[model samples]
Every structure is written in structure tokens, then in C-alpha cells.
Target chain A: MVLGGLIGLAGCALFPLLWMLSVSLMPPGAADTLPPPLLPQHPTLANYRVLFAQDGMGRYVFNSLLVASVTTLVSLGLNLGAGYAFAKLHFVGRERLFQLLVGALVLPAQVTMMPLFLLLKWMGLVNTYVGVMAPMLVTVFGIFIVRQYARSLPDELLEAARIDGAGEGWIFLRVVVPLIKPIMVTLAVFTFLASWNDFMWPLIILTGQEHYTLPVALAALSREHAQDTGTMMAGALVTTLPVLVLFLVLQRHYIQGLLLGSVKG
Target chain B: MRPQRLTGWLFAGPALAVMTVFFFIPVLGGLALSLTDFDPYALADWHNLRFVGLGNYLVLLERPAFWSALGNTLYFVVAGVPLTMGLALAAALLLNHRLARWQGAFRTALFAPVVTTVVAAAVVWRYLFNTRAGMINVALQAVGLQPVDWLGNPRWAMPTLILFAAWKNFGYDMVLFLAGLQAIDPFLYEAARLDGASAPRRFWHITLPMLAPTTLIVGLLTVAGYFQLFAEPYVITEGGPLQSTVSVLYLMYDDGFKWWHLGMASAIAFLLFALIYAVSFMLLRLARKRGAA
Candidate 1:
């Protein structure tokens, strides 16, 4: 009975993904036919070819990669510095300021969309890649994660560096950063996947088709090509493949970060 | 001391500045915007903006569409949370069993959906539920059951979104529950068994009580997370077949971005934030009381 239940659970979990792969390779219109074939009798790459060759999917892929990477790099730098400071610094009102930031986490990001659009518009950044990447540049969760990790660092290490005449900037860059490398990687993965999978902000800010990220592009494609099941599935595959691979490779850290973010909250 | 204080500010300066300009300012500005009559007219001309205090909220309260969106959102949270949590608990229990085999593979497969992009999965699911030439209908036909228009029909549209929400989110809760289950001491179950408790009684008496904290946390997190339902409906139904699946966030998006009703959109966003805060606060209070009891 236990074995049977496990098999059933696994099958239910895997069916959608396997079906996604199967349909992506099937001959155009094959999976949509009567008694949907478990295995495509005539497998082909026509759908994928159409997506990358003519549909500007390559450009969208590049845009997703570029945006996610830049956001990850920039946010990591900002979060690590701020987190370490909040953790170890003896500045005035430091505790109050940190509390303010933490308290702001409960305010949903959606609440700021309207005015943020206007703000970006005024800055002449709307419809640009920077606009698409701006709101995500410094996440509260990122700062929190880094701060939590940084708080556990030994105070004597910092004092030793200070007594050795290491400047504050030098301590941050040379001492703090190297010690926090693992959390930085975890933060990078988290930020990258989030920025890549982000739909609403990019969908709102990046107006031009040329600047459309994968999620926004796929959403548009789905709307325009609702009847084209094969092509849509291929688009879905392209949009989801990278992050899915990233999650599978670094799933331990990703899941760890998820629980950390939730439980800490 | 002076240099250390300055250095701390220097380290935190960039992040604080970014959050202030991008996050905090916009949120406060949104609140102010909601009080004014801001729209496309105001976008084109400053003179068109008028200070209309509480006007947008009042207008939204009266509007049928707003109420429908609120109702739809409530329906989603009410239905989706339990379904997802139940499925997650069941999965966790099955995985926790000593008799279960190949637990690693089952765990990974179950979690596969959580990692996939929401827009992409919604797109695939859209096709899966298509009325004609869709697998769901084809299966129904084979089984001598009638095919339901999953996304097209008003009655089934919201339910379809709820089902998709469950499929996408149960994995997250499953992982949390698994962690919680592992934290449970094996001796508790042994004690219950030695006391002549049946399997069901053991689960109810020992397991449930021990898992309360986990359940509360999971419930609060799920409620807050699910309350912000936007991407699924955006990609799946586009708030439609008659706006049956329009969520609060979706309403804000349409008003703010689509129709350029900035003021009204800001009101919707704040209302959503308020609702989530209230709901989560009450749940946590209830959890605390239950814990004390």
C-alpha cells in the first residue's frame, strides 16, 4: 500500500512536467488530437525552431538573462553592505532604522505600483531595462536574509580588522564579503529567479515589445496565439527552462532561503 | 567612535537610499494619490487633478466590479488555502511514513511545480483545460463523463484558478510540513501507540497538537501569499470570461496600468494591503490563543 501511494504521488507530481516535454516535441497539432498521445508518435523540433528562429525568443531569452543577472549583482552588493552594517554597526538610531525597514516588509509591493510608475516616468526611466529592474534592485527580504546571516559573525573579527587599521570600507569589502559568500550565492539565486519570473512589474513598466521579458512576452504570446497550442507550449518551455534548471541544481539553498524568509517573518 | 558611526551609515546608505526612493516614497505617494481624482486626464494635465478626499474609496465601494473582485479574491483565499494545505499535509504524512520508499524522488517531483514560472505554467494549464482538442476534455469523453468548460464558463473559471493555485502552491506547504514533521519526536507516536491509540487517534491527539505551531505559521504565510493573487489570473484568464477571476491585484493592475486610473488603482492597492494585514493579524491572534490553551 505504501509503495502504491508513493508511485501515485510521484506520477501525479511528474505528469504535468512530462506532458510539457512530450507536447513540446510532438508534431504540430499531434497532442491536441483525439486520445492525446502519451508519447508523440512523430516527434519533431518544428515548434522550438519556430520559437527561436522567427519569434524573437532568442532576444527575450537574452533580456531575461541580462535583467536577472544585473538585478542579482546589484542587489547583492547593496544588501550585503546594508545587512552587515545593520548587524554590527553602532550608529545612532540604527536599531530604529532597521526596525522601520523590517516593518515595511508587510506592505505589499502592489501598493506602490501606481506612484512608482509615475516616479519612474518622471525620472525618464520608464520603458527602459533599468525601469524594469529598478523596483527589484533592493529587496527587503534580501537585506533581511543577509542581515540574519551577518549577525552571527563574530564581533572580535571585525574589531581585529579595525585594530589592524583596516578602513571601514576595507573591512566591508575584504572581511565581510568573503565571509558571507555562501549567503550571497543563495541571495543571487533568489534574486535572479525572482527577477526572471517577475511578471506584473515588467509587464507594467516595460511597454515596448523589444524590451519584453520572457514572462511578459509569453503572456502576450499566449493571448495572441491562444489557438496555437504547440507554439505556446514551446514558449512556456523557453521561459521556464532556465530557472527550473537553476532550482534543480541549487535547490537546497533555494529551499533554505525560502524557509528562512518565511520563518523569520 | 565618530568614525565607526560614520562608517555604519556609509555602509547602509545605498540600500536605505534605494528603498526610500523606490519603495517607501512610492507607497506613501500611492496613499496620497488615492485621495485625489487622478486619472488619464490628470496624467495629461495637472489642472485636471482635484483633491477628492475619500472619493475614490467611496466610488470603489459602490462599484459592482470592485465588489466582484473583492468577492472573487475572498472566494479564492477561502477555498484555495484549505485545499492546498490539506493536500500538502497529506503529502507530508505519506512521505513521513517509515514504510514509504523512494522518498527523495517523490519529494523533488512534488516540488517541481513551485520552481516553474507561474506565467509559463498557467499558459500550459490553459491549453490543458481547453474545451476542444484539450487533454482534459478528451479524458472526460473517454470516461463517459461530460466535459466542463474550465476557463470559459463563469462558474468554473474561479474554481479553475483555485485548482491551479493549489497545484502550484501545495509543494511549498508540503516542504514546510515535512520539516515540521521531522521536528516531531518519534517517542510521542510510540507513547500514543503504547496507550492503545489507533492510527487515526495518534494523528489527531499527538500529531495535530504538536504540529499546531507549524500549521499556524503555514496558514498565516499561505493566507498572506494567496491574498496577493495576480499572476495566475493575469496569465490564465486575463481577468475574464466576464471578469469572474479578477483579483484585487488584477483590479489594481487594470486600473493603474490598463485604464490609467492611477488614483482608483492606488485605492484598490491600499484596500488590499489593509485586508491582508487585518486577516493575518486575526489569524495570528487566534493561533496565539490556541497555543496558550
Candidate 2:
């Protein structure tokens, strides 16, 4: 009984996605059916082909890939340095500043959106890739995660490095970077997935179709081609397949980071 | 430890600088922006700007759209949070059950939606809930039930969104509940079983209490997350079908970007922040009273 119930819930969770996959592969008019066939009668890649070649979806996919990857790499660098300093380095106003940051987390990111848009406009970045990528290049949560992990690193190693004539930059690159490699990977994945999935800010910023990320493009497609279920599903599939694959491959780091975040900051 | 002020500043400078210039200053600027009549004219040329003080906030209170947006947002929170939490608790309990097999697979399947791109998933959901040729309508016909326009009808729109939001989010909370369930001692259940307590009785008395802290945290997180509903409505309904699914954040996006009403949009943003902050504070206080860590 328990097993049956569990499977039922899991099936419900997965049914929509499975159905989407089935319909995406179906011939053009196949999904408009009586019983809604469980499997495509003749599976074809025509929808995907049309999406990439005709609809210019490949550009959106490339945009999403570029933005997410750049945001992840840059965020990893910024957060690692700041978080390590908060954890291991002693400085004036360290505790106070960290406390201020933790408090600021309560203020929703929306509070900054309107003015940040103006700020980006003044810097002549509005409607550009740089505008969409600017504010997200460093995240408070990323810094917090790195700081939480970095606190566990022993100071003795850093002191010994200093005694060996290693500067702060050299020690960070050689010592700290290797030690916190796991969290760095985790943070990278987190930032990448988030930027890929992000909608609102990108929607607000990217005014032109040429600059639209995959999510923004999919949203536009859904509105314009509301009748084209097959193509919409294909678009959705391409957009989601990458992150889903990454999650499956690095399942441990993702879930570990999730639990660690929930249990701690 | 000796203070390394110079090195610490050097290490933290770039991030702190970015945060200050982009995040902190803009947050303060949003508040300042809210106090002015910074419309599209102001955007075009700086000569149109005017310090309106509380006029924007006052104007929002008078506006019917703002109230409707707030109502829709509250409806989502009041409706969506409990539904999602209930599903999460049930799923967590089922996965934690002693008889459950292939637990990891089940957990992964259930949690997959949380990781998927929202816009992509929302597209799939839009297809499934389509009015005419939708799979849902076909299934309804199979069951001899009438079809309803899930997204096109204003009444059903929010509820359909609530259902989709719950499905997308419950897995995340389920994981949290699973962690809480694991932390509970088996000996407690052993004791209850020995004391002639029925399974339901044990669950009601023991499981619920043991899960209270997790429940509080989950509830807070869910409420906070749900109150900011935008993308689902944007992609699915476009806040359409008579503006039924217009959330506060959605309204802010429309006002700030679509219409270029920066002052009014900033006001809406701060109002939302205040509401979330207040509710979070209350939840934290309640958790403290319950000795929740």
C-alpha cells in the first residue's frame, strides 16, 4: 500500500514532463487527438529541426548558455574571495559587516530592481547582455555559502604559507582555492542553473528578440505560438535538458549544497 | 588572531564594491525613486523629475489595480502555501515509510521539477492545461466530465496556477521534511508502539510535534516564495483572462518596465518588501516561542 501510494505521487510529479517529451517527438498534428496517445506513433525530430533552423531558437539557447556560464564563473570568483575573507581573515568591522549582510538578505532583491535598472541605464548597459549579467555577477547567498564552508578551513596552513613568503593572492590561488574546490563547483552549478532559469529581470532588461535568453524566448514563443504545442514542447525540452542533465550527473553536490543551505544560512 | 585589515580589504574589495554600487545603493535609490514622479518623461529627460514625497505611496493605496494585485498575491499565499506544505509533508512521510523501496528514485523523480527551468516547465504546463485540445480536457472527456478553461477563465486561472506552483515547489520542502524526519529517533516510535498507541495516534502525537520546527521553517519559506509570484503567471496567463493572476511582483514589472512608471513601481516594491519582512519577523518570533532552532 505504501509503495503504491509513493509510486502514484511520483508518477504525478513526472507525468507532465513525460507527456511533454512524448508530444514533442510526435508528428505535427499527432498531439491533437482523442485519447492523447501515450507514445508518439512515429517519432520525429522535425519540431526540433524547425525550432533551431526556422525559428532561430539556437540563438536564444546560445544566449542562455553564454549568460549562465559567465555569471557562474564571475560569481564564483567574487564570492570566493569575499567569503574567504569573512571566514578566515580578521579585519576591522568584520563581524558588524557580516551581520549587516545577513540582515540585508531579508530585504527582497525586488527592492533594488527599479533603481538598478536606472543605474544600468546610466552606465549605458540597459538592453545589453552586460546589463542582464551585471547585478547577478555576485550574489549574497553565494558569498554566505562560501563563508560558511570557509570557516572550517584551518588557519595554520595559511599562516605557514605566509611564513614561506607567500602573499595573500598566492596563498588564495594555491592553498584556499584547492581546499574549497567542492563548494566552488557547487556554487558554480547553483549560479548557472539560477541564471538559466531566471525570467523576470531578463524579461525586463532584454527588450529585443535578438537578446532574449532561452527562458525569455520560450515565454515569448508561448505567447505568440500558443497553438503550436509540438514546437513549444521542443523549445521547453532544449531549454531544460542541460540543467536536468547537470543535476543528474552532479546529484550529490546539488543536494548536499541544498541541505547545507537549509540547515545553516 | 591578528587583524589583517589591509589584506582583508584587498580580498573583499571587488565583491564589496559591486554589492555597494549595485545592490546597496540601488536599494536606497529605489526608496528615493519611490518618492519621486519618475515616469517615462523623466526617463527621456531629467527635467521632468519631481519629488512627490509620499504621493506615490498614497497613489498606490488609491489605485484599484494595486489592491487587486495585492489581493491576488495574498490569495496565492493563503491558498498555495498550505497546499504545497501538505503535499510536501505527505510525500516526505511516504518516502520515510519503512515499507518504501527505491526511495532514492522516488525522491529524485518528485524533486526533479524543482530543478527544471521555470519558463520551460511553465510552457509544458501551459500546453497541458490548454482549453480545447489539451490533454487534461481529453482526460476529462474520458472520465465523462465537462472541460473547463484552466488559464482562460479568471476564476479557474489562479487555482490552476496554485496547483502548478504547488507541484513545482512541494519537492523542495519534501526534502527539508525528509531531513527532519531522519533526525527523529526510532526509539520514540518503538516506545509508542509498545504503549498500545495506534499508528495514526503515534503520527498525530509524535510525528507532528517532531516535525514542528521544520514545518515552521517550511511555512515561512513557502510564504515568502509564493508572495513573489510572477513568472508562472507571466508565462502561463500573462496576468490575463481579466487580470486574475496579477501578483504584486507582476504588477511591479508591468509598471516599472512595461509602462515606465518607476516611482509607482518602486513604491510597490517597497510595500511588498515591508509585507514580507513583517510576516517573516512574526514567523521568527513564533518559532522562538516554540523553541525552534
Candidate 3:
């Protein structure tokens, strides 16, 4: 009975994506009819073609890719370094600072948006990719996750590297990096997925249509093409597919990070 | 400073700098801005800004729209939290059961929604819940029932948002609960079974009690997340057929960005922060009380 229930719930969870994929493949006006077609009798990529060809979806895809990739690359380094330091290195007020940051998590990102926008404007980054990327460059949760994982790393190895005359940066590069490779992947997937899926910040910061990431662009497209079900579904598929695939491929690391950051931490 | 301390500072500097400059400072600055009448005029010229000293908060308190937004957000949290947690706990329980199969595939399928872009998912939901062309309506009509206007009706709009929120989020909590369940001693369950306890009794006596901390954490996170309801409403309903779905954050966005009432927007943000903090505090207290009892 429990197994049956699980299967049913799983079906409910998976159906939206299946329905989306099926409808996106439908010919124009095909889904507008009564008793919506479960499968396109003659599935076509026409909606996808329209999205890319006419709607400039390729540019938004590029924007999302560039932002998520760069943000991931940059954040992995920053979060790892800070996390390792918090775990191993001794600093004045380290505990207090970390606590402060963690406590600040309750303050929603929306609170920062208005002033962050002004600050970015002052820095001449308004409507730029940099503005969209700025707030995501370092995240408190990312740092917390890394710190939790990094604390589990043995101190003997780090001391051995130190006694062998390895500098902090060199130790981090040569000794620590290899040891924390699992977390690196986990954090990378976490950061990448987060940056890819982020909406409100990007929507607020990237006012220009050209700079809009996939979510922002998809949202804009949705508002305009609310009536165009097939094309909109195609847009939804395009925005979702990459992150979905990434999460599936890196499922282990992602779930590990989720558990680490929430339950165990 | 000692070399070790200096090294620690160096390692932590970049991330700290980014967090400080981009996030921490803005949060404080937002608070400061809330104290003044910061409007577009102030945006153009800082000279136009004047100290209002809780004036924005007072004004927001007086505004009916703000109250309705708060009501709408509270409605989402009150209704949505239980639904999300209940589904999450149910899924986690089922996944954790001995009879469960294809566990990995099931986990992946369930968690997929959590990873999808909110705007994209909202778009899919918007279409799925569309009045005439939507598959939901089509299915309803096929069943020989009257089709409901899911988004277009004020009464149904918030509930639709709640459903979307639950579907999007429940998996995250489910995963957390799975971890919690695994941590429970198998001996305890074996003992309970030997004591002639039925499955339901074992669950209530063992599982729910054991899972309380996880439940508290999940509950807090879900409530906090649900409070910040923006993207779904913005993407799906645009806050309405009649502004019935406007959340506190939505109001803040409207005030801060759309109207350029930065001061009022900042006030709204702080108010939301306080609300979340209070709710979390009360939840923790309640959990502590339960534990003590």
C-alpha cells in the first residue's frame, strides 16, 4: 500500500514535466482544444523553432549559461576558501562573524534588492550582467555548507603540509583542494543550479531585455505569450531542461549538499 | 596580527568582502533608507530625502493594500506550510519504507521540481491552470464537471499559488525527513513491533516523535520560504484577477521598484524580516515547550 502510494505521488510529481514536454512538441493551436491531447499525434519542434528563431531565446540561453557558469566558478573558490578558513584557520572574531552571517540568513534577499540596485547603479553596473551576478557571487548558505563539510577534514594533513613549509595558499591549492574535491563538485552543482534558477534578483537587476537570463526572459515571454501555450511550454522546457539534467547527473552530490546544509548541519 | 590569523583573514577576505559590500551593507542601508522618505525624487537627488522616523511604517500600517498583502501572505503560509510538510513527510515516510522500490528514480522524480526554474515552472502551471485552454479545465470538462477559473478567480488564485508552492517545495523537506528517519535506531522499531504495536501506532509513537526536530526545521524553512511569495504570483497571476494574491514581498516590490517608494519598500522588507523572525521564534518556542511536556 505504501509502495503504491509512493508511485502515485511520484506520478503526480512527474506529470507536469511530462505534460509540458508533450505540449511543447504539439503543433500550433493543437493544445487549445478540449480534452487536451496527452501526446502530440505528430510531434514537431515548431514551437522550439519559433522560440529560438523569433524570440531571441538563444541570447537568453547564453546569458543564463554565462551568469550561472561564472557565478559557480567564482563562488566555489570564494566559498571553499572561506569555509576552509572557518574550519581550520584561526582568526579574530571568526566565530562571531560566521554566526552573524548565519543569523543574517533570516533577512530575505528581497530586502537587499532595492539598495543593492542603487549600489550597483552607483557602480555603473545597472542593467549589466555584473549586476545580476554581484549578489550571487558569494552566498552565506554556500559558505555554511562548505564550512560544515570542511570541518570534517582531518587537521593532521593540513599540519603536515604546514610543517613541510607549504604556504596557506599553496596548502589550499596542493593539499586541501584534492581532499575536498567531492564538496567542490557538490558546491559547484549547488551554485550553478541556484544561479541558473534564480529569478527575482535577475528580474530586478537585469532591466534590459538583452541582459535578461533565461528565467527573466521566460517570464517576460510568458507575460506576452500567455495565450501561446505551445511556445510558452517550449520556453519553460528550455529554461528548466539544463538544470534538471544537471541535477539528475550530479544527483548524489546535490542531495549530499542539501542534506549537509540542512539536516546534518 | 599573527601569521595564522592573517592567513585566515586572507582566505576569508574575498567572500566576506562580497557579502559585506553587496548584501550586509545593503541590508543596513535598506533599514536606513526606510527611516527617510526616499522616493524617485530622492533617487534623482539625495537632497530630496528627508528623515521620516517610522513614518513609512505608520503609513504602511494605515494602507489597506499592505494589510491585504500581509493577509494574503499569511494565508499562503498558514495553508501552504501544513500541505507542503504533510506531503513531504508522507513521501519521506513512503520512501523510507522497506517495501519501497525504484527508490533512486522516485527520489529524482520527486526532487526535480525543486530544481526547476520558478518562472518556467510557474509558466507551465499558469498554462496548466489556464481557464479555457488549460489541460486541467479540459480534464474537468471530460469528467462532466464544470470547469473552474483557477487563476482568474480571486478565491482560487491564492489556493492555486499554494498548490504550486507545495509541489515545488515538498521534495526538499522530504529529503530532509528521509535523513531524519534513517537516523532513528532500527532496534527501537523492532522493540515497538515486538511490543505488539501496529504500524500506525509505531509511526505515531516512534516516527513522529523522533522526527520532531526535523519537522521543526522543515516547518520553519517552509514557512519562511512561503512568506516570500513573489515569482509565482508575478509569473502566473500577476498578483491577480483582482490583486487578491499580492504577498508582502510583492507589495514591497511594487512600492520599492514599480513606484520607486524605496523608503516604504524598505519598511516592508524589515516588517517581513520581523514577521519571519517572530514566527520562527514562536515555532522554536512551541517545539521546546512540546519537548519539555
Candidate 4:
């Protein structure tokens, strides 16, 4: 009975994703046929081919990859430096400053949408990749994560390095950077997936089709082609598959980071 | 700890500066903007901006669209939260069973949706829930049920979004619950079994109490997350079928970005922030009191 229950539970959890895969492979109009077929009678890559060639989805895919990767690299640099400082270095008003940053998290990102849009527009950043990447360039959550992980590093190591007359920059690069590689990788993965999956800000900022991220592109596609189930499924598959793969590979760190953020907050 | 003050400042300076310039400034500006009649005209020329004080808020309170948005948001939270938590708890319990095999694979598969881009997944769900050619209706027909227009009907639209929300989110809570369940002592279950407790009884008495903290956190997170319903409604329903899915954020999006009613949009944003703050505070307090009791 217990085994049967477990099997049923697993089945329930996996059904949608499995169904998505099955339906994506089905020939046009097959999936929505009466008594929806579990397996495609005629599998075809026509949907995917059309998505790539006719729909210009491949461009959007490249845009998503570019935006997500750039955001990750840039933010990682900013967060790592700042996180290390908060954790290891002594600074003026450090506790109070950190508290203020944490407090800002309560102010939902949406609160800033109106003004930030105007701000970006004024800066001529709107509809540019930089515009999509700007607000996400340095996140408080990323700083907090890096700080939390950095705090565990031994003070003696840094102290010893400093004693050897190494400058702050040198210490950061030669000592700190190499030491925190794991957390850095973890933070990089976290930032990349988030930027990749982000829909709202990108949707708002990237008004032009040329700059549209996958989520925004997919959303537009869904709106325009509501009847084209197979094609939309193909779009969804394209948008989702990359991040899904990343999560599957780095789930441990992702879950750990999630819990850290949640519990700490 | 030497030169700690300067070093800390140096470390935190870049992030703090970025956040302050981009995040803090805009939020404060948002509040200030809410007090003004900042419209599309203001977007073009600063002279067109008029200081309206509480006029925007007053107007919003009397607006039918605002009320509808609030009602839709409430419907989403009230209906979506419990359904998500319940499903998550059920999944967690099933995974916690000793007889469960292939647990890792099952967990990953379940969580796959959570990691998927919301807009993308929402797109897929839109197709799946489509009226004529949707696989959902086809399956319903096979099961001897009449096909319901999932997204087109005002009555069924919000519920469909709620169902989608539950499916998309429950896996997250399931993981949290699984962690919480693993932390529970097995000896308590053994004790319950020895005392002639049935599985359900054991679950009710021992499982629930020990899992209280987890449940509280999950509930709080779910409520907060659900309150910010935008992308799902945007992609799946477009807050459509008689505006049944018009969430507060969606309303703000429409007002601020689409219509260029910057001042009114800012007001809606602040109002949402206030509501979320109040609700989460009350929830945390209630949880603490329950724990004390």
C-alpha cells in the first residue's frame, strides 16, 4: 500500500512535465485530439523547425543567453567584492549599512517600476540590453548570499596575507577569490537562472523585438498564437530547457541558497 | 579585523551604491510620484506634473477597476494559498514514506516546473487550457465530462489560473516540507504506533505539531508570493475573460506602463506593499502566538 501510494505521488508530480514532452513531440493537432493521445501517432520536428526558422525564436534564445550570462558575470563581480568586504573587512557604519540594505528587500521590486522606467528612459537605456541588465546588475540578495558564505572564512588567513604587505585588491584577487570559488560558482548559477527566468522587468524594459528575452518573447508568442498549441509548446520548451538543465545540475546549491534566503529573511 | 571600518565600507560600497541609486531612490521617488498627477503628459514635459496629494489614492479607492483588481487578488490568495500548501503537504508526505523509491528523480521532476521561466510555463499552460484544441478539453471529453472553456469564461478563468498557480508552486513547498519532515524524529512515530495510533492519527497529532514551523514559513511565503500575481495572469489570461484575473500588480502594470498613469500606478504599488506588509506581519505574529500556546 505504501509503495503504491509513493508511486502514485511521483506520478502526479511528474505528469505535467512528461505530458509536456509527449505533447511537444506530437504532430500538429494530435495532442488536442479527442482523448488526447499519450504517445504521438506521428512525431515530427516541424514545430521546432518552424519555431526556429519562421518564428525567429532562435534569435530570442540567443538574446536570453546573452542577457543572462552578462548579468551573471557583472553581478557576480559586484556582489563578490561587496560581499567579501561586508564579511571580512572592517568598515564604517557596516552593521547599520547592512541592516539598511536588508530592510530595502521588504520594498518589493515592483514599487520601483514606474520611476525606474522613467530613469532608464532618461538614461537612453530603455530597449537596450544594458537596460534589461541594469537593475539586475547588483542584487541585495546576491550580496547577502555572498556575505553569508564569506563570513565562514577564517580571519587568520586574510590577516596573514595583509601582514605580508599584500594590498586589499591583491588580497581579494589572490587570496579571497580563490578561496570562495565554490560559493562564487553557486552565486553565478543562482544569478544566471534568475536573470534567464526573469519576465517582468525585461518585458517592461526590452520594448523592441530585437532585445526581447525568451520569457517576454514567449509571452508575446502566446498572445499572438493562442491557437497554435504545438508551436507554443515548442516555444515553452526552448525557453525552459536551459534553466531546467542548470537547476538539475546545481540543485544542491540552488536549494541551499533558497533556504538561506528564506530562513534569513 | 584591522582597519575594519574602511575595509567593510570598501566591500559594501559598490553594491550599496548601486542599490541606493537604482532601488532606494526609485522607491522613494515612487512614493513622491504617487502624490503628484504624473501622467503621460508629465512623461513628456515636467511642467505638466501636478501635485495631487491624496487625490490619486482617493480616485483609486472609488474606481471600479481597483475594486475588481482587489477582489481578484483576494480570490487568488484566499483560494490559491491553501490549495498549494495542501498539495505540497500531500506530495511531501508521499515522498516521506519509507516505501518511496526513485525519490531523487521524482523530486527533480516535480521541481522542474518551478525552475522553468514563469512566462514560458504560463505559455504552455495557456495552450494546454485552450478552449477548442486544448488537450485538457480533449481529456475531459474522454473522461465523460463536457469540455469547459478554461480561459474564455469569466467564471472558470480565475479558477484555472489558481489551478495553474498551485501546480507551478506546490513543488517548492514540497521541498521545504520534505526538509522539515526529514528533521522530525522517527521515534515519535514509533511511540504513536505503540500507543495504537493509526497512520492518520499519527499524522494529525505528531506530524502536524512537529511541522508547525515549516507550515508557518510555507504559508507566509506562499501568501507573499501569491499576492504578487502578475506574470501568470499576464501570459495565461491577460487579466481577461471579464477581468476575472486582474491582480493588483497586473492593474499597476496596466496603469503605469500601458496607460502611462504614473502617479496612480505608484499609488497602487504602495498600497500593495502596505497590504503585503500588514498581512505578513499578522501571519508571523499569529504563528509565534500559536507556537507559544
**Candidate 2 structure quality by residue, lDDT tens digits, B147-185:** 999988999999999999999999999999999999999
Off by over 4 Å in 3: none
Off by over 4 Å in 4: A28-37, B1-4
Model 2 chain A weakest lDDT span, ten residues long: A256-265
For candidate 3, the per-residue lDDT at A211 reads 94
Candidate 1: give the clashing pairs.
none
Cα miss at B36, model 4 (Å)? 0.9
- Write the number of the candidate with greater lDDT, choosing between 1 and 3: 3
User: Residue B228 CA error for candidate 1 (Å)?
Assistant: 1.5
Candidate 3 structure quality by residue, lDDT tens digits, B1-293: 38999999999999999999999999989999889999999999989999999999999899999999999999999999999999999999889899989889899889989998889899999989989878888888889999999998999999999999999999999999999899999999999999999999999899889988888888888888888889999999999879999999989988988999989999999999989889988988898999921
Residue B195 error for model 3, in Å? 1.4
User: Which of the numbered candidates is closest to the native, going by highest lDDT?
Assistant: 3
Query: Candidates' DockQ values?
Result: 0.78, 0.79, 0.79, 0.68
TM-score of chain A of each: 0.96, 0.97, 0.96, 0.95
In candidate 1, chain A reaches a TM of 0.96
Clashing pairs in 4: A90-B4, A90-B5, A90-B8, A91-B4, A91-B5, A92-B5
Cα lDDT of all candidates, in order? 0.89, 0.89, 0.90, 0.86
